[model samples]
Target: MTSNKTDLPYFSVVGIGAGPANLSLAALLQARTDQRIALFDKAADSSWHSSLLHPGVRMQTSWMKDLVSLVDPTHKLSFLNYLVTEGRLFAMINSQFDVIPRREYMRYLAWASGQIENIHYSTPIEEVSFVEGEGFYAISGGAPVARSQHLVIGVGTRPTVPAGLSSLPDDRAFIADHLALHLPTMSSDKTAPVAVIGGGQTGIEAVLRLLGAGFSNIKWLGRRQWFQTIDDSPAANEIYRPAHQQYLQDLTRGTRRRLVEDANPTGDALTPGVLRTLYQANYDRMLEFGEYPVAMLPGRDVTEGVLDGKDVVLHCSTAERLEQHRVAYAVIAVGRQSAPVPFSAELRERLDAGEDGDLVIEEDYSVRWKGMDDHRIYALNRARFSHGIPDANLTLLPVRAAMVINSMLGSELFQIRDELCPVQWG
Candidate 1:
């Protein structure tokens, strides 16, 4: 077929969302192959998790698990190289922190992004469609802007508010992503009652931020029996390796999903020292005042939230009873859901979906779609059920990218070798 849009820019690969996953893939593709690759993101800049990047808050993963090190340690855009080239190597080491600050990580990402080529920020690819024999076309603002032989969707996740709480007044109740933006206009009275929902790290960080902002009356709610810390032990860390990921790939879908859910405690819980920090801050506030400034309520599952006059009333249930709490404002950090892909209706219908209604992703991360020949679409961070816990995080970022690149090129361009495994997988 003759190309009609010959004047427009064309790439071998067009990746949506230049987040860490896509950034890793783009970096590797640029270094290893002569492939003309381009990445498009809706965000104006590479400020990852910017809203929840509170001061003193640290990353859950180690600095070693950066974008490129796992598969290509010698890559020019490795985190170590970033520190050296940016003149922060000695200072970063001297800090001697358990984990580096997330703000620093964001800076490292932005720095690395600047060095990469053909990354178009502030450009949203609204629709992606596949023409019969012409490959993929990325449409923005109702017109095709770029053509690509391959597509990679890595748009990442967005903070989700529960359906029950979705109707809450937007100004008074909101997701954690907007907490920082809404803090100033919150309340003139520091003691105004507020609630931070969800038991994960984001929820704790919200509580800490409220305390720091001089909020005297704050309630921290969690569905679990208690606020849980991540299992950062040696054994737990081993699950993040490539070997375990491969082991997970061999399991049946149902079995793999169950195992991955079981592994959530290893990475999904609160970061170490975060809960302690919250507790110590509450204690100090208690010492100053007659009572603790923050109230920790665990095992309370918030089922509904409604605006009662100026306050947001949260209806929660416990193991034995139901209760209600009122607060001037609520910051919801329940969890995040995957961002929607911009696939056109025709293309969406042609893709093979799983029992879960998501695209059927193969072991190598490519989506099983109709009419796939030399052109293919790869999905990143969307195969948790088959790829295990590491699929949803920065742990095996480069390794996943390598898998996609190897599968795309039909050769072993990058080798992933995870040796010295102590635990055997069945």
Candidate 2:
């Protein structure tokens, strides 16, 4: 570890993690103001959800909701501009996709990231501390790399496997992201059985990937009674608007949490297009094999797993009774939990946290800390219950960034206007 240095590069804002959230903020700050900004990420290069960009997989949100479009459509880094600049405008127009492919979105983000300035790649910030009079310092490699008046935490979530499956052999049972890496080691026979645990979008995607890999016997398990598609109706979409988010903030904490829980189906379920594609593919395989290649086992809550000879046996509890499934391999796609914010012990003690041990975020996404008079810390993608479902996904990417910018600048840098609301939250 290198020694701490007093003289470090100074910036108006030092953002950790070059994911979509900070990238959105960086693009906006570059376009709207001349403030000194820097973004640091641990990855070697720009990529978004790299492991999960399976063939035929698509984004759940529309293309219009790119990094800088919804708030500042004229921004040079808009998704439309990327296509036009890259000579794919006409091709994209002709494709006429309801939602663009996930690979395409990843490519767009990489392109936009290339145009942004002061983004430090392959640099992982270990801890952030405050110096009282000197603002915030981002420490990396046991020394201060950058100092800034503000810090943004965007070190996105990580895939999680439950405690029961945690002890499973890594070579046999692993997270969904490792499916491709572990696939070739498993059986090459198309009829070999494999199990995909989790019923949400990621689980379905894993099952689809297995199908593409010619795995005829696939067990798809989930806790839900049945595989459910997203609620894509206009009324359901209203939950993602700025108006609904503002109204949610006005309610009591208990009421807001309950309302957000009720609104999960709007954005948390599987995409309708992907579900339809899976159904059609399953039907096509059934026509040739006289039976379905994939067996849908919903309403089963997976409880434990243990090795049985060469097979991994999964024990689950259903609505009726307990059951067991023996498979060659299991892909766990349960869910994701937030990656921790590496705050120094002193700094963390000065900050306020919620009952869930997350930062107490303000309306503008800034944290409620003890000594925030001279400096501030803003967190994105960490405010789902407070900001609603849009906080977790890419639906209102730029709008959220605009709110953070306006709050940082102490002015209406971007006017967020949502009009003609038919539904009354009151």
Candidate 3:
């Protein structure tokens, strides 16, 4: 029934990662509550997708979906305020772009990170364990550095590589996260064959970047019938509204999962701008070389790849036939998987788990774990099925943060009002 302060530095809450999800949570709680919350990240500094901040890459989501706007529009940390305070408001308007640049978003996140009071960088949390009466302890560097009454895990996702390509040496093959870093070495041989795997936005971006870098021979592979652009139409956009998110809760888990899958074009596809940019560039190049530089290979899933001397051989299967392609370099952009939770054995065994060992996320984003008396662990961006597609996107970030804060404080500190439904579903 007692705890000592000398054992570990304590707080009301501790966030595992300082990415967008937890950053939004920290910003809201910092502005509204006196409760002490700290974040620990293994990153050496504050950065979001730093290496992949490609020169031409832009955000798919609007800037209005910033961290605090949906719940607290007037908060000093709004994206509008960031633009104004940083002296870029008019400059941004002059550009007349549909979406902000990814680099700008990363800068906004870094700026927000600096404003938040307690974010411990370069501090890796290896284990998060809960003792019966003492609350949660975040162990770092082989010792418990911090303790908290509650925990929020928002470490984000990691790039994935298939088993066939995983064994390739670092120089020959890697995920797209390292593309920028490898561009110089890659550009040395502009005519060398390059293979990019996966069908999503990342793969398309990789192909586009290689084309921009004067790479002559590039093979772009996709599992789908064709490359797809985001359906950001008004009706499709309505799926990301908070009203739609709540409506999803009433449906069965199986049905909710199906809807999220069907809404893939909204988030998982390429931006129309990027697709058009590639097309125009390809057209211009064809005028000079009499052929397109990048070969678009769709309706084919790359089943395996192997290192053949300095080259990588990719085995792919299409509806009609099987094929093999060789390339000097390979970039695997096959999507991402959620980052692992640093839960200790004692804590992990007690939590309600799904078939995949993930925490069973409740409607409020908190995980149903044992011994959650006054303390809780909230998982952000981990419940795509239950919360709809917006659960894993920037659209409802502030709303989710507000819900978590409201549930944590047991009162309506921040009111979330999504009014006027365009579509009513049973």
| Model 1: colliding residue pairs | none
* lDDT per residue as tens, model 3, 246-338: 888888888989988998888888889988888888889999999889899989898888888888999999998999999999999999888
TM-score for candidate 3, please give it.
0.97
What lDDT does candidate 2 reach at residue 198? 96
How does residue 95 of candidate 1 score in lDDT?
Answer: 91
Q: Look at candidate 1 and tell me the lDDT of residue 186.
A: 90
Clashes of 3: 0
Ranking by TM-score: 1, 2, 3
The candidate 1 region of ten consecutive residues with least summed lDDT is: 1-10
For candidate 2, write residues 158-207 as lDDT tens digits. 99889999998998799999988888887877787899999999999999
- Candidate models: Cα lDDT each: 0.91, 0.91, 0.88
C-alpha TM-scores of all predictions: 0.98, 0.98, 0.97
Model 2 RMSD in Å is 1.4
- Say which prediction, candidate 2 or candidate 3, comes out ahead on TM-score: 2
